[model samples]
Target: MIKTLDSVSNHEHRQIIEKTGYKVETLRIWKTGILKHSISNPSNEQLETFAMNVDAVLEKSNLHIDSKNEIRANCTSHFLNERRRTSKQGKETKENIKVVNNIKKKIRDNNLTVVKADKGSCMVILDRNLYINKVEEFMNENGFVKLDNNPTSRLINKVKNFRVSKEFEDKFGKYKNLIPSNPKIPKLYGLPKLHMDNIPIRPIVSLINTPVYKISKFLSDKLKDLTEFKPTYSIKNSGQLAESLKNLQIRRVLN
Candidate 1:
């Protein structure tokens, strides 16, 4: 895989790829699945740890709840952080440029897709009819209803307010709909690299209403993983940036 990615192009071939369906910022190499851990059933030790953590948090806050109170939310946050940490420390999974070129070659050779090279990037005009059929079947099986208006038509604007009003209450917290939040489990956001890049650089997941809400929630959850360090504890000399900012404000008020 490494050799294949290496052989594609150093720089010149990037333009070739842009002409294909994958334009700049849309192309990404595939990475390992990010949400695999949370979906699987937890082990005994994992369950015990989760229970203990929830108990500790609740005890401090004077909150009490039964075991069925959906602690999965908290556990999912912790597990995703673990995965992100592992990914940052792990090796790069992206095949070099050559791998992409090779994929293009294979698609064209088999007549599976038509590839075109443009100055900016390569374009691969996939069979839209085939994809539409597949999507129709998937939507039918998934219990989704079609909208009365065409998604791209001016008629969409007529009912656009309905979408805005409803999607917020349904997806995010009250009055906090527009924020870009991280997902708890990474989904196939229907962008380029069908299965690649857990986080696309500039994701189009926002274009689709359901995925926009999901991705935003995940982003919000991911932000909580920032570490809080303390200074003058005698063990660690450094404080976290957030803590330092707070300390500076205190000193200014005191002075």
Candidate 2:
């Protein structure tokens, strides 16, 4: 059998060698075509060890092969593109953090309270009484005329009377009946409601009625120095800011 195997060409011997199980000695014998004097069938223990080694080699090879296949399927440029995308995201996150920190610092420097609301919007609240006092001081300094008291009730009465008057009837025409006889006026709890030169001045705590795009644009303008920062305000943030400001007022009232 050894002589016949030796007589065969190398290609024939290789073909025979490929068909055998993963026994190292068997392959060597078939490949070399040399029969060692002590040649014998592998022991069961030897076979098991050889099989385990072969499986280990195959598993390692398969891992490398799968990686190569993935690279080929996605194109060779995939790794580079993935790295660049991750780097860009990291840089953007860092820039956003820096901008937010800067805004917080600015607020602190101005001795104002800034609270982050939902959807990336923030609220700036000032002491209402202090702010009103400042406005009064400024008006007094400028020799501006001021009303004796708040005109909230007076304005409500005026609006109510106008709704039932001939002017409202002439303007609204058929819609006159649709107007409520006793319309409820929105109550201003902690807001400053003063009159200057007979013009009613009311402080707004909520910007909920303002457009999100406008708010974003406003924030962008305010924080323009932070070139990498882009503002994006949602309507939800506006409502949250209003609610927070109201809570602040309620806290003050309770205190």
Candidate 3:
């Protein structure tokens, strides 16, 4: 397996793997069905120490819940600092996760879902069925209807046929390079607005791989060049906005 990994062409391969390494021994001992522990790349001495520590905890410490929790040794618990920690640990632990246990029953009883925060690496707990109903309500309010069947394949064929048609080719031949070779069906999804009181789901249409992607991109680029003349109103960032505000003037209207 090491030899096979070394022979893998895409990598700047290691010439020879280290002998008596913990990782190598782990792979050598690995089974087909069983997954290996991610962080427990323990050497012989570390393994022995870990076993002794576990024995110490079980013998010296009470098997009671609070005592068991109190007996959490760094050596006994693998990757004490890293195993269950996430990048958003500070934010989550401080604001969200601390109260999660208290609300667990309330969530389960209400049949709510615990989904991810939209803009940040946090959690947003909301009822998924209720969320779906609200989304459906919004869609209905905006005159959007549910389709009876998926029209993705049919839509693709239609677009492809139109692209190859004589009239279409004649009209759009100059922009052939801008046309996408392969197009994907567009998807619509919603992100939870956690900051809002009602926690509305903000609708977003993902268009990167869709049929209109290339044409829309081209049009946007063209429009940008045309609209760049209005520099005062077309503020993009905070810096530009600030600069625009600084130069603002309200002229008195001549009656």
Candidate 4:
């Protein structure tokens, strides 16, 4: 439904237009210029990530969250088993086994980068170099070197317990990006809102880290609405206090 595309911004937009047979014509008007990002896919991963990032900010408004134990239980009964069982339903039992084997193959192919102990409270993966840097930065900023305890101590206990009352999925209900670079960003419909996002450091070196904020659909949708093109311009021009708070929070987490 878009007409002449204006000056488009970002690589994803350009990629979409290129792949989708959309054309763009950039024009300058007076002293100002306008952009028109036209596309057939209309949806993008970066936009999804942005919505998630903004939603984390909105979740702070609720001042409620779940504890670590509840988060772990929800992760087990809901996420892990549910995915396995759901995959088994639509396909032959052997096909489901094949799917699970492929997943295992992927895990093993990565040199078993992630390893876990059943009884241990912490999940440890092979350390990646780049992730080390980010984690170090996070530590320098927050005076903490470990993420294992942070989830249980800092955030898990701080938030109130919530349940997966209903099934949830992403905006398009298509799993575009299941993992994130920022752990604080909320999952689509998963419980234990807070998680450890990873960064690749090297062939095997990666840093696993956590986010300070935990978010849900209510916050995600609100942030999406608030961050559409109009709100961004308004925030840039008039939202000094809000911007400062945002900067502060980012600094607190990332340093």
Best by TM-score: 3
lDDT of 1 by residue, 101-167 (tens): 6655755654443333222243323444433454455556768785786444343333233344567
lDDT of 3 at 70: 52
Predicted candidate 3 versus true structure: per-residue lDDT over 1-255, tens digit per residue: 332222323212122111222244333322121232233333558667866777676777558865665555544565444434543454444443334343455457767655444555444445558667857766878899778988877866665565445775586564456546777778766766555555566787889877768778877877878788455546689997788689789899998
Better of 1 and 3 by TM-score: 3
lDDT of 4 by residue, 1-255 (tens): 121112112212111111112112211110122223222221346545655665566465553455544544554465446556645553544443554455346445554333221222222333233334544554466564434543433443343332332344534332223222345522211111012223211122222333333244445666778776355444454477576577564434554
lDDT of 1 at 99: 49
**Residue 123 error, candidate 4, Å:** 23
Give Cα-based local distance difference scores for all models: 0.42, 0.42, 0.55, 0.36
Q: Model 3, which residues run further than 4 Å from truth?
A: 1-123, 161-182, 193-198, 226-234, 246-255
Cand. 4 Cα-lDDT: 0.36
**lDDT at position 30, candidate 3:** 26
How would you encode candidate 2's per-residue C-alpha lDDT over 1-255 as one tens digit per residue? 121112223222133211112244333433443222331333557646755665566566746776656645454355446556766766655555555555446445655432221211212133334445644655567576757986656754553355345774585354324334443433322222221232122333343322233334445665675586544654447777787567563334553
| Cα-based lDDT at residue 181, candidate 4 | 34
lDDT ranking, best first? 3, 2, 1, 4
Arrange candidates by TM-score, highest first: which order?
A: 3, 2, 1, 4
* Deviation of model 1 at 43, angstroms: 54
